[model samples]
Target chain A: MSLTVPTSTTLVELQDVHLSFGSNEVLKGIDLKVNKGDAVSIIGPSGSGKSTILRCINGLLIPQSGKITVGRTRVDELKTETERIALRKRIGIVFQQFNLFPHLTVLENITIAPRKILGISEAEANRHARDLLEKVRLEQKANAYPGQLSGGQQQRVAIARALAMRPELVLFDEVTSALDPETVGEVLAVIRDLVREGMTSILVTHEMRFAEEISDTVVFTENGLIVEHGTPDEIFSKSTNPRINSFVNGLGGRATPLHDGEGI
Target chain B: MSIVLKQERAKQLPFGGIFAAVLGLTVIAWLFLNQSLGQVLLEWLPYLAKGFTMNVLISILAIAIGTLIGIVLGVMELAPFAVVRAPALVYVQIFRNAPHLVLIFAATYIFPFELVIFGNYVPFPDWVKAVVGLAIPASAHIAEITRGAIQSIPTAQWDAAQGLGFSRSQSLRWIILPQCIKRSLPPWMNLYASITMGTALASLVGVHELLHSANDASTAVQRTDFTVVVYLTVLIAFFLFCYPVSRFTQYLERRLASR
Candidate 1:
């Protein structure tokens, strides 16, 4: 009953990545490195392959030519689906649309993998799932279905669901884009909480303010290329890349600063 | 008021006459079953009941098998991955497009085909052939219903599970299938009832199911009216069997809607 607990560092590294879905190319020879502890935000316009990068990291979509590694395991070289699943156990993803299982209770949704794939006993998984629910301040919603919860509440549950896997790297795909303004802050708060734990997160998001406030590195993507890569200040204030500047400044390069002389 | 009533009357209930027609038919049917009291019960009852029960048996077995297989194929056909879904589509297309009669006959006679292919076969009982025949065709219809129900589930749901690191199979097992099964149940049960009624096809293969027994009794008694009573009994029995499931399905539908 002893699974070799992998104590490896060097989480995810993507080198010369290129992917094409028919005539449409998504990832174009992209190179990126995510270390053991890093909070990076990937920001870009629609159709600019921000999400595709996350998918490639998890092996949901394989790049045509890339040398990718996750943990001690090589990504492109994983021979079987079982291997990929085993690897993804270390990599958790929070979708843009919170996909808390509608049919299952919040607790059940969080603990399914622990119970099934990890071979953890149901009682143990439930105990752990309860803790995850508590982390999101949704302990009361442990038994409730996803339908009973609001969009923000559901997203929190999704975050809890991902953390239940206790992954080294968590990917957030525009976690607040689908939510109302009132709800956006709540979801962002949960991500901030994760940052407190030093959980490595790669967030594909449009919330420039949140990105600027929290991320260690912010990459501005345009037409399947990384136009600018730097700290939040570097990107917002001192970015030389015109495409990155225009994208961040919205209204075509009108830098709508968040506060007076406080553009972080 | 009269003009409004005239306009509303058209839409009030177009099928009101249907009740009257059914009542009239029932009276005629009762006369056939109720004629000669003890004699009617003695000669007609056993034979009609026996055939009716056999038909029920065949329908139950066939529908049960069809339902299980349909659920599996249905989930497969709805898979997002082309690798998993393509084979399922091929199976669905083959079965769904083939005539029900052809499937039934082929399943009934499949042992011989199995023998020809493998150069060996098990000696199947007559009941097995009839029941398998009915089930094979019924499954095709059931698979189509299951596929539709699975498809009606939102794509966001599948993606959500995918994002959770659930493999294609795991997502289906834990998330998609459960919802699909619940949604598919009402229509599935309805199909079950229909297949039960259709088990009369056993009579074609010289099986003494309900309809077969009824025909036998009609020929023996030299009374054509017994056939009416046999059919009436069948309709009532079916109504008895199916009404509760239909009600349950409706209740479930309403409950899901409220959610």
Candidate 2:
């Protein structure tokens, strides 16, 4: 499929991004540009630091060195916790664990960040929360506690909670990895529906077929680095990199069994 | 294997065992070995009853002060920077290391002349001084318990709240502290019960609590049996005040654990 950006301008740019957890580097001098209204799927193995990339954008983990700009805010330069927090409200993150506030009902979880941080009145926050819940087809479950819901339902609630903040950019850090195969489609469908409506998204995912369906670009990661980037056709169909060919084949890509030195 | 299992489950007995046993044995031993339960209960029923009210007033005041001080010191201990955490450790060490009775005695005798003097005068009653004395020492251990509870929550929670744009104080006020209070409630309630029972030691310094009232009445009656009876009444008073709060603590613990 031909790629199209869902946004009017570039929403995120990572230049020489380097991060470490005391001496173990997770992101090594990565550089990338994602225009606004774009849907990019980052695919990689379990420990490839795909999730770390999403976390760094919102200041959940600070990069030791380099520059990451999310719209107008510089990710590394936001020094105080307060400054980092102020920058986070503009970026919504959906987690793999579906981190809904288990102590609160679905509606309460969604409206909490908006009502507390943005100072939206209860009536106003309620209206927006209800609208987002409706979008995710979870309006009926508004009164339910997170523990009462199925994994798929919890994920949908998580999406509504993030959207209630009305973020300029949404990050999905392998959000469906923890779900059962039967439940994955429902969440993927919600995300696809959001993409259809022009929401800028950067998704860390392993679903190759799904990336082919909705992504404007497919980024392949390995050893804490972005190894390749192209349209799904170029990366999946006509790749010259032996590593890319081996990696895509291991994912059971297209069933042609492209032979190489690293055969499965 | 069975012995290992027994050891695993053994961390002192539950409310059904040692803790409750201490409460029960103290009452029964006070009654039968020393005096008749009903007769003793009736003897200082007035002074013991009035003293029971006074003891309760001190418990409420101590628990409130303990919890507030615990939160402040607990947060200071958990602060990310070393500047705040280092001094907090000294505070916890000093209080936890010292005997509560010694601190209470010192507060009553020394603090008036040292800290609260205006031209060498303290504008307070003895009872207020005693309450402050009990609360300060009790709070030191409370601060340590509170810090451990706060630390046990996943740092992801703090990160999540911050990612949602909450200020550090706001994140704590909204999320972290509520969970800590819920998590710490059982031990905290036990701590409150402990120091309220410790108030009997206040009688040694003249606080007029249940045991003190019993001492006064027994001396007035000139009977050791009367002292036994008064002490049993004090036991009853402690149980009456502590049971509801203990039950509430259990209810909250189960709810939080399930979450």
Clashes of each: 3, 6
In model 1 chain A, the worst 10-residue window by lDDT is: A1-10
How does each model score on TM-score? 0.81, 0.86
lDDT at position A231, candidate 2: 85
Per-candidate Cα RMSD to the true structure, in Å, reads 6.7, 5.2
Local lDDT at A128 for model 1:
93
Error of 2 at A92 (Å): 0.9
Q: Chain A vs. true chain A, TM-score per candidate? A: 0.90, 0.92
Q: Candidate 2, which segments miss by more than 4 Å at Cα? A: A1-8, A252-264, B1-43, B113-122, B255-258
| Top candidate, metric DockQ | 2
State model 2's lDDT. 0.78
| Model 2 lDDT at residue A88 | 87
Q: Per-residue lDDT of A189-220 in model 2, one digit per residue for the tens?
A: 88988887778888998767777678888888
